[model samples]
Each structure stands twice: as structure tokens, then as C-alpha cells.
Target: MGDTEPRLDRGEALAATGVGCFLWVPATGQLILDPVGRDALDLLPGEYRGLAEDLRPKILRDDWTLLSGLSAALRGGLKDAYSAYFRVALHDGRSRWTHVRGNVVRDGSDGVTRVVGVVRDATLDLSPSSLRPPADEDSDHLHTLGEAAIALARAMSVREVGAVLGDELCLRRLGVKAMSLAVLEQGRLRLVRSVLSLDDAEPPQKSRLADSWPLNDVVRSARPLFFTSVPDFLDRYPRLAPHQHGFHATAAAFLPLVEQGQPLGAMGMFYENTNSFSLADHTLMTAWSRAVARALHRVTMLDRSREIAAGLQNAMLPRRIPETPGGRITVRYRTARQGVRVGGDWYDAVTLPDGGVGVAIGDVQGHDTEAAALMGQLRVAMTAYAAEGHPCEWVLAKASAFLAELGADRFATCQYLRIALATGAVHAANAGHPLPLLRRTDGTVDRLELAGGPPLGLPADWDLTPYSPTSARLDPGETLLLYSDGLVERPGEDIDRGLARLSAAFSAGPADLEELADHLLDTLTPGPHAEDDAALLMLRRDAA
Candidate 1:
């Protein structure tokens, strides 16, 4: 009887403050709510002691959907505490905004056993703004946060993530006046983006991590720092007094971007009208920071992966083309713009045993690491066969057999040719490769028609037709071009038309082989979003 009197007094005290407590046990599906909580949820005194499911009909359907995930977040052990703003339907046929802030009690295995929290009526706190409707302002604010998260998830680079955060529309949606993001690199903070309203003045692009700036302090401590006013910020960090004009905000919040227990960087948000952050605002900002951190980590990993792929691809290509005394030889290799930046397009200029220059250009079946590996092996085999004094046709045949023997379930298109340095004589063979362009001394370009066989790696019985050889002569001041299909393939376009365009460009190109190679790339290459690898090899016999 003595304990009951103290409990009653405590409940009365909580009711007077308009804050009510709730205890929920997930295992037994039991819920207990105090008088204030029951009144806010529109539940009768007797109805408050029932199961949690019995109160579902009192919540707005969309709000229930939004708040229901809190349980999963606790059960999965992903979050220890959460704050949610949702709508509840009252018996008077009207909706009231309710705010709940709770902490989970986890058992030994980290499963949520119980939840203890406070509930309050939040309808009066939903302020009207130009960006949202008055009736569902809180819901619209949450929608804006969801949109930002979706945009961040698709961001491919750190700069892209900053762009999403700094977009003016996104800022307006979230009622923020300005935003900034910085990344940590080698003990320094490199500012990625900043959208301040100050004219002709902004913070430095880079700062030492040990500096006394709010961003640096937040990163070092892995905590959030909020300033309610300019004076408050200056009082805490007096060293930044000189740069106060650059911020120009009444309030600001700096959050650390930490992933996997490592501090990656920090994000800063400035507000004009806000004098202080409410509990709801603080919770939302913290959650948003976590989403931004995850996105930054993901993009950084992708950047590293692309770098590694590009390095491997460059290492496999020829470091230098053999100096051909007969004529000038120029080559260029470009990675795809849209994907992994690695592919199987390769070019080789090998000095043959008979003092002739042997050149081969080929593209493997795919644009992945396995294709690149296969291309390396095939190039080595072809170069070796040419050095052993094999004919152009025989070299292609041996390459095909080598690819088939690997059982890689892939194929490649190749063009191999041997040219006599002194005589300008050419013997060429093709395997499902594009036709080479021959430019006459008069600057007229025409495709050299040649018999072709299937691409390499075909079954022995499938390639009964031999790879036939074609003979051609290179005259003085004339060029012969070999290129990958990427140079002529376009989406929603005909390859023949692209080939015709290339022929025109080649005919009008400069006499210098090096300059001509550049001309072809500058004129014939696709836009920045080209999705296939391209390789080019050009040889021009010296004028007699």
C-alpha cells in the first residue's frame, strides 16, 4: 500500500507535465500506458492494458506503416533508440500528430526484449512552411529525407553525393539554408562542396584535421555539434571569428561521417530561422548523417575498384610500339566510359623474324576481367607465333586453336598482317574482324575487301572454311588503318553508316600518322557516355 501511493504520485506528476510513459514487452505482447499516454492515443483507461495489436486501428494507416519498422530495427539489433512522429485517429474523426521517443532493452543475444519510451502530442509542433502542406507537414518532412537517401544511394562518387546534398531544391525541401560536405584524405579535410549564401567569401578548400574547426572537432570526436546562434558558435570556437561572415547562419549542426568505426569526414547544415533544434530535428539530422556516411563509403570503394581495373588493363598493353623504319606507326587505346573501364581490346606491333613488321588488332567477347586475361594470353601466343616465322594466316589459326584449348567459352575477332619494310608488301588475314581502310596517295579511303572466317574459339568442325589470306601494297604517302568495332558501332544506328563516316574522316585526315590518329579520335569517337572499348593502329609508308 505504501509503494502504490508513491506510484500514484509519480503518475500524477507525469500527467501534469503532459508527458506519459509506456512499457512494452515484445515476448509476452503486453503493453502498459500511463494516463497521459492513453489520452494522447485516444484509448480508454481500460483499453490501454490490452495487446499492442489492439491499438493498431487507432493509428493512421500510413503512420502505422512508417512506425512499424521501429520494432524490426530493434529486433535486428541495428538501432538502440528511435524517435518517430506519426498520426493517430481520434474518436472525434480527426487526426492528431504524436511523437514517440524510445529505447530498446535487448537480451543476451541482442534481441529486443522490451521497450521503454515517452509519448506526447506533437500536433502543435508541426510548423507550416512554404515547402509543405499544413495538415501533414511532418510526413512531408520525412518524405524529403527519404528522397535524399534514395539520391545518395545512387551516387557514384563523393562529388556526386555532395551535389545531391547541396542541391537547392533538396535544401528547400528540408528547410535548410545551406549545406557543406568534406572528406578526410591524408590527415587533411578536403571540402567537396559548399553552398553558402555569402557572396565572394567562403571557407578554405582544405584544412588540417587538427584545426579547431567544428567540422574537424566533430570528425575527431565522432559526435554531433550544434550551435543555436552565431554567438554560440563563436563563443565555442573563437579562432573562427574571422570567418564568421562566411557562415552567416543563425544555427548550425555538424555531424561526423563514420563508417565501420572509422571517421571518413563530416557534413554541415546551416539554418536561418531555427534558433534551436527540437528533439525531432536532432533525431532526423543524426539519421541523415548515417545515411550519408554509408553512401560515401560505397562510392569510395567503387572508385578504388575502378582504379585497380584501369591499372591492370594498362599493364597488359604494349609499353612501346616497335620503331618501324618503313613507315610511321601510331596507336591509341581508350577504356569504356560507362562501365568498369576495363576490356579486351588490344593492339600489338611485333618485329618479325624476316625484318617485316607484324601488327595485330583484336577484341575479346566481353568487357570484364576474364576477357582481359584471355586477351593477354592470346596476344602473347600470336606474338610468339609471328616471331617463329609463321605466315599471317597460320598465326591467326594458331591463336584460334590456343583460345579453343583454354575452354573459356568465349571468342575473339582478330586482324593480323605482315608488311615488308623495304618493299611495302602486305599479307593479311581476318577472322570475323572489321575490314581495314586503305588510303591512297591521292587521299581517297576505301575498305579492303577480304575473305573472313569465324571468330576465334569456334569448334573444329564449325570452322571448316580456312581463314583466307589477302594481299595488298602500301604506296608512298598512303595509310592503312585497323580499328576495333567500337569506333563504328552506335546505339540505334547502322554500322555501315558509321563505317562510311570513318572513311570520310580518314580520307580528310592529316598526312602525319600521329596527327591523323588524333583526328580520328577527336572526330569519330562517341560522346562521354560511350560504353565500349576502342583501339586504333595506323601505318603510313614514307613518301618516295
Candidate 2:
């Protein structure tokens, strides 16, 4: 098609008919929707590229099924151009009767490659039965109700929402016999905890979609399925009748829950008697379903974020001990089993061009992926600030300002240490973190306590967490220990006790850097617990 000569006559013909041109590239699964076509269809401006299956929802479901598939149209018979008449269901509640004529572009062997088409609005020619007008009244009522539901759902915490969903006043308005929200988890609809009319009612015992073909089709089609009578539902699925043995329901409705066209789950409504759902009941449930879908989407995103955060942290953290011109640097990263969830502890080392090295360890405040994501941002800023050859105090100051400017609500405690290899001098800056421990050649250990500034992500523009750049000489056989509070602190124990334990562990450990790093934590605590993630960065100003 790309090599074919321009058809001036074809272009003029389309223009005369006031039609829009389109191209479907199967290789990329892209539908090039023209601006004119989009206007007629009432699509968003951002919905302009790489759209293939995205078109399915725009066309009426029945109409889409009637259209011949691309493969079938080009199967061994160079099929001539054909016309398709369908009703477009716009997302903004508009409808369009569309006429499309397309021809498959085939290779020399007649294998279909691309499809080119022209579309025209045929609303004037189509009768009411063929083309429905805009659903303004229903959409308006539904949208208004959906907004109210969202507002109510958002105001309540997840627990509160769960508690109120079935017995709550808002839900009672529907007068449903029973309601269950089942989210698709691990390819199954697991019933979320909620209040139900039947005190000990157990939802469909089957967890996976394979156990219920009716529910699977409902989710797959992203449509509502209602059974006004038992005979109708039972006759449709005799195999599933036995599975519904204990249920006492005369009517049922399953409204598929979808977000961004992806099926998330479904909400099931059961009634005690055979009944028709009034238009008002249907609209109200639609609103509730939307609200429920949003809540589920939020939770799903948080879980996804945790996985992403852990992966991102792992990727960015130092993989191998950095090569230094002087001292030995060993790092141990322990993730919290509970307190910080999966994304809390991180350590990094970046070498400077002047035979110097900068190291920092910090704990971001969070138990989930949000905290981990913030940790990444702050760590990257620290790395860049350090690598930029800034001094300890300057790096900390700039990093703090960067975090504050970035609008991170949570704060992090960081301890930055810069070692000058030529002089064996260590400069330190603290940001509300545990003080570093210093050990001399004579087996004496003492805290290099510094009055560090506030944690990062605070309104500390006036140098509130001012970096003073504490100076210390790193003589051969001496050590400096830096760690997150998790290494020392316990739930009920005092801060002083934790510090005392850390000092005792370092003093009792061997002179070897690696062994000492491992021994330090082992001596202080039995093993990593669920409270918090611990980080240890040890440096031996190696024997010169």
C-alpha cells in the first residue's frame, strides 16, 4: 500500500461524500482514527494512536460480531472491497450510524497486510430501529449518581467501606436480597468481605471462573446479565444448577466491573423473589458498581506499586562493592519483614574523580511502594549531588532542598559521609539519622555525635537541618559505622539502649570489615524482625 501510486479519483470521491479516511495496520495493531471521524464518534483527543481492540467498545456489540473478521475477509480469495454498517456507541453518550467501505491490501501471494477504509455518517438514512439516538437522559442520571457514589466511597476508609457496603444505608436503598463484590484475583473471582442479608451465606464456593461459565461470560463481555426466573437461568446452564443448590434466589443480576475497558471483576445482586429491576434500580447499581470498581482499582494499583518499587530499588542499588582508591567499603541491606513492607532500606556508594568516595544510607518513611518510590527519587538525587563533586554538607543541603521542592510529603533520615583518600579525613553530614560510631586502633569505640538538621522533605529552606560538616581523621585500623535506626532500635526499648547495643556489637566484632558488618547486627539482635528494615554500611580506613 505504501508503494502504491496516489489515487486522485479516490480522494476526490471521499471528499465529495464528506467522509473520513482510516487505515488499520495489523502489524502494529494500530487504527489511524482521523480527526473528522473522531468528532463524529465523540472520542477523546488523547485516544488517537495504537488503537486496535479499543475500537470494539465504540461499535455496538451486536454490530461488531456481524462484521467479517480481517482473516476471514482475506482467506485465499482476494476479497473485493465491502461495506459495513454499524452503530457507534460513543463514550460521551452519543451514537452514530456509520458506513465504512474497506479493502484488504494483500501481498503478491494474496496474504492480507493492511486495511484502508473510508467512513461516513449515515444517521439520516438509518431508521430508529437501525440507529438509536444519544442516551443523554440515562447517561446524565447515571453520571450524577456515579459522582455521588464515588464521593461517598472516597470519604470512607477501605475498612469503613467494607463494613458499610452491604448493611449500610446507602446500599440498602437498592433493597437487594444480597450483594457480593468479587474481584478477579489470580484469574478467579474471590468474594471480598462484606455484610450480606443471609447471616451465614457463603458466596459461590467456586473461586475460579472455570467453575461458573455464566459469571465468566459476564466478565468477558463486560456486560450485565440478569435472570428474572430460576427456570431461565437453570435452563441456560444445567451444569451450573447443582452448584447453586444452597442459594435461595429467585432473581439475580451480575454487573461486570471494568476499568479502562479491562475487566476487573463483577458485582452480583440477588433477590428473594422473581422480579424485574426497575430503571432506577439499574441506574443506582450502575453507580455503585462504578464506585466499587474505583476502590478496587486503587487497591490493585497499590499492590502493583509495591512490586514495582521493590524491583526499582533492587535495580538502582549498588550491585557490587565500588572500587575505591583507599578504604574498604562493605554494605549489608536487610528488608523489613513488616514495618516497611517490601520497600524501605537502601544503600549506595559512588566514587568521585578526585580519588575520594561518597557514601550514604537512608530510610524512607513507608511500608508500601509509595515509600520505596520516594526512596528512589531521593537516592538518585543524593547520587547525582554526590557525583557532582559537592562536599558533604553541600550535598546534604542540596539533596534536602531537592526533596522539599519535589513535594514529597514524607521525610527521610540520611547520613552522608565523604572520605578524602589523600588525607584519610572523613567529613560527615547528618539529617536526623543515627549518629555514626567511630573506633580507634586501641579498641576504643565512641559516637561521633553531630547535631544534624531536620530530615529531608521539610520546610528547612533556612538550613533548618543545617549540615555542619563534622571532621574526623580516619587513621589506619580505625572504623566508622553508619546504619539505619532499625539496626539498633526496638519497639519498647529506649534510643540510648539501641545505641549502646550497636556500640557493643561493633567493639566485640572482629577487625575484618565483612565479618564485623555481619557480626555487628548479629550481636545486637538475633535476626531481622518485622518492625523495620535495617541497613549497615561499614568502612575500615584499611591499614596504610
Q: How do the predictions measure up, each by TM-score?
A: 0.63, 0.43
Candidate with the greatest lDDT versus the true structure = 1
Worst 10 contiguous positions by lDDT, candidate 1: 127-136
Model 2 spans with C-alpha error above 4 angstroms: 1-312, 460-465
**Local error of candidate 1 at residue 210 (angstroms):** 2.9
TM-score, predicted candidate 1 vs. hidden true structure? 0.63
Q: How does residue 225 of candidate 2 score in lDDT? A: 90
